[model samples]
Target: MKNITILLILLTLTFSNVSAQKIKDGETVSLNGLSVTFNITNKESVTVGGKNFDRYKVSANLVNNSEKSFNIRLNASPQVASNTNLVELDCINATGAKLTSKKMELKLKAHNLNATYWYYNKEGKYVSGVLPVIAGYYLDPGDSVNNNAIFIVPQGETPDVLLRKI
Candidate 1:
């Protein structure tokens, strides 16, 4: 019985360490009975096409926390920001407000025999010009995906992102 107690304590501590690896901001949302959260880390700004934009490095984590494997379709839009301030980074917004969708467009393509996806954006009306916004992810139980995106918002405005089941 003493040995069993020791094993249990070790297991508990192991789990605790795993959970502590990431910071939780209480930004959980329930999608089709699954617990999901989006975290924005490492935000910055850059000038593109004579204008400044907000860029974000983001991650979307889907936790099953259940007995069954769920087949889910997650729509993770990189260019779209959530209406909440959950994923805001401490970066200066050069635009002063969020850029409208018309001012920018998400450019994504699959490479390596369609094994990987690349993300970039075109600023202004010119096709030869490109900005940076890495956005692409899918959903799987106990899986996390990364997306980085640039928003057309000025400083002090954070883009809102959302996840939906389809």
Candidate 2:
């Protein structure tokens, strides 16, 4: 009986440690020419560029340890750009989840900008207009290092933006 109890305890501890472990959904190596440290957690149903993403959440923590401000932009394509105004989607900060249908655009008047994405255009183009606002937080300088966004996959559309962090 004593041996069984000990084995059970060890198994419980191992399982607990595994469950308690935090898995990162995504990682940002560099941002805005500054080394950034941040992490995102609890992500699901992630699809980008018409591909079903394996990872649900993106968690990133800066390794370089640089304190700097950078601009982050999220853009989508294959869906023609229109004059239609972009709408803010529902978001939660603690969970780091965002849902938006429209594409996001940014006009950078400054030189300091950091953009990260899963893939880019053939010409290595970056999106400019129709930016999506998630969780009432705009990607800009002096934002939280643990920021996250969600780009909704348009119906019958592939080649979507999966993750973008700066």
Candidate 3:
């Protein structure tokens, strides 16, 4: 029975769809009218007005594939996943308040450039900028921007952001 179970597990893993495979670092996922490439980087903490902050940052390169201005229609919330399980980290506000959501979404309007998006700079502060993947920011067609999305993951836990399509 043990040997049969092991063989079954192997067969299941081998027969899984290619789309179920995890998107590794430096890989790009394209959907709808946008494409995203991900890379996780160490948090570079910075102090502002005597308060220090650090975060686990994931930088994503976003490309617009439409001929005109594009509005964000995809759910851009990222998940931290491991080999065995996928973890959902708590969503925190700028004032350090915990929220009920574990997912983040982006809602950019068409032709709206210079809009402040939710970007956590390398300095570790939650500020609005053009370099944000999970917020409202306009991207002209054929244009790409390296957006920074930071998470408030706990210390000592190395997290892998996973993008899975259902």
Candidate 4:
């Protein structure tokens, strides 16, 4: 009886980890019966305050893969959890030098201006607010949606985006 209980506990944990995955650029991960991915479509600029800032344009996609429909609020501000990171997504160079784990320990710092998928406008074309609004998406079975977000990094470097959660 005791051994069966322990086996069941381990199985539950393994299944949970499988669902909550770390998704990298162009990779799809399953979370709560949904297939989600973040892809950098291109790098573009948004003019703000009479100045122009370059930003990476990312497209987030979510597809309902299960037999039933569901609703999920994207964890846009995952940095607020037990661990704190400087950036929302772990943006690293394509080389992946000094990479230890799939997840990076983000240091508290700043580099340039940017935006989030939260809030924006026609002039600023900004989605940088706090989401309000990670777009508030809910879908039925077999439904899918594509959402856009932007992040700014230093010039001449491309970010290899890695998201631990949705």
Candidate 5:
């Protein structure tokens, strides 16, 4: 009985550690000289236009946690090639609503890439910009996309921000 209990405890600990390594809320991944932290919140599944889809809202913060100012560009590509299934949602006010009539979709091609620029000025101040992928999609519009963003962090000495799927 004693041996069995110890074996079970060890097995549980090993499995727990391995599972923890997988991406979850508040998990940080390192890229370039920067430490990238991913915080995904409000993940839910909803249906629109007679189709069921998964939607996740995510906020990414790039920390220069290092000693120098850096320039970072955020980018993401769809996992699947189909364009009609991928959509980005826009939020109106505090509530999440599909911005209507307008069609919002992110377009990622093999040749062209989407990029957003961020400048980490002195004193650890972070400034960010958006590279709109899907033009017709809006927050308040009545549509949603089945796509997520892919972040790329370049190799360099400065801090960088990469893309992620939320």
Candidate 6:
């Protein structure tokens, strides 16, 4: 099962990278000397825990095309509401009436979780990015990091910001 899962993930990354290479314009952004490609391969909605949520699957590929090692920070920007801790889901149900959910907060927790995405170390081997308590990480020369994130957006009055980049 572990091997199958790894194979599936590798396939996903391979396909995503192929799509990333077809960007026409601003999808590729440069920071210092690193070339980061952001691609949104899928966008839709899903029902989780009886609530409607918009889903955005994004793949952020960071390539240290330069010769130096650099510490990179993936800052959660206000302009990108998808990266926030509290994602507002759609308040209305199928019939259009608003849902009166109780006032409750939920926190997600994980322990010793294996890395799911793809990254390359200084030795060029596939690995995972250093998981920080916050956003951001480091990149070494010839290293490539594929950072994938799924944004669960609430349905209703559309959010102030959508997942504009992949």
Best by lDDT: 4
lDDT of each residue in 71-148, candidate 6, tens digit only: 444454322222321111221222222342311111111112233567888899998664434333344687775544
Per-model TM-score on C-alpha atoms:
0.38, 0.22, 0.37, 0.40, 0.30, 0.35
**Candidate 1 — which residues are off by over 4 angstroms?**
1-26, 71-152
Flag regions of model 6 displaced more than 4 Å. Answer: 1-26, 48-51, 71-138, 156-166
> What is the alpha-carbon lDDT for the whole of candidate 3?
0.49
N/CA/C clash count, model 1: 15
Q: What lDDT tens digits, residue by residue, belong to model 5 across residues 59-153?
A: 44444344543222223444433342111222211222353211123322223345588988777899876674532212212221223322211
Clashing pairs in 4: 116-128, 118-131, 119-127, 120-126
Cα misplacement distance, residue 44 of candidate 6 (Å): 2.6
What would the C-alpha RMSD of candidate 1 be, to one decimal place?
18.4
Clashes of each: 15, 25, 0, 4, 20, 7
What is the descending lDDT order? 4, 3, 6, 1, 5, 2
lDDT of each: 0.43, 0.35, 0.49, 0.52, 0.37, 0.45
For model 2, the superposed segments whose C-alpha errors exceed 4 Å read 1-28, 31-33, 37-40, 45-144, 152-166
What value does the lDDT take at residue 35 in candidate 1? 57
Q: Which model is ahead, 1 or 6, in terms of TM-score? A: 1
Q: Residues 26-110, candidate 3, lDDT per residue (tens digit)?
A: 7877766666666667665544445554455666566778677744433344432112111112233322313212332333433
Candidate number that wins on lDDT, 3 or 5 = 3
* Candidate 4: RMSD to truth: 15.1
Candidate 3 stretches with Cα past 4 Å from truth are 1-22, 43-55, 68-138, 152-157, 164-166
Off by over 4 Å in 4: 1-22, 44-54, 71-137, 164-166
- Of 4 and 5, the candidate ahead on TM-score is 4
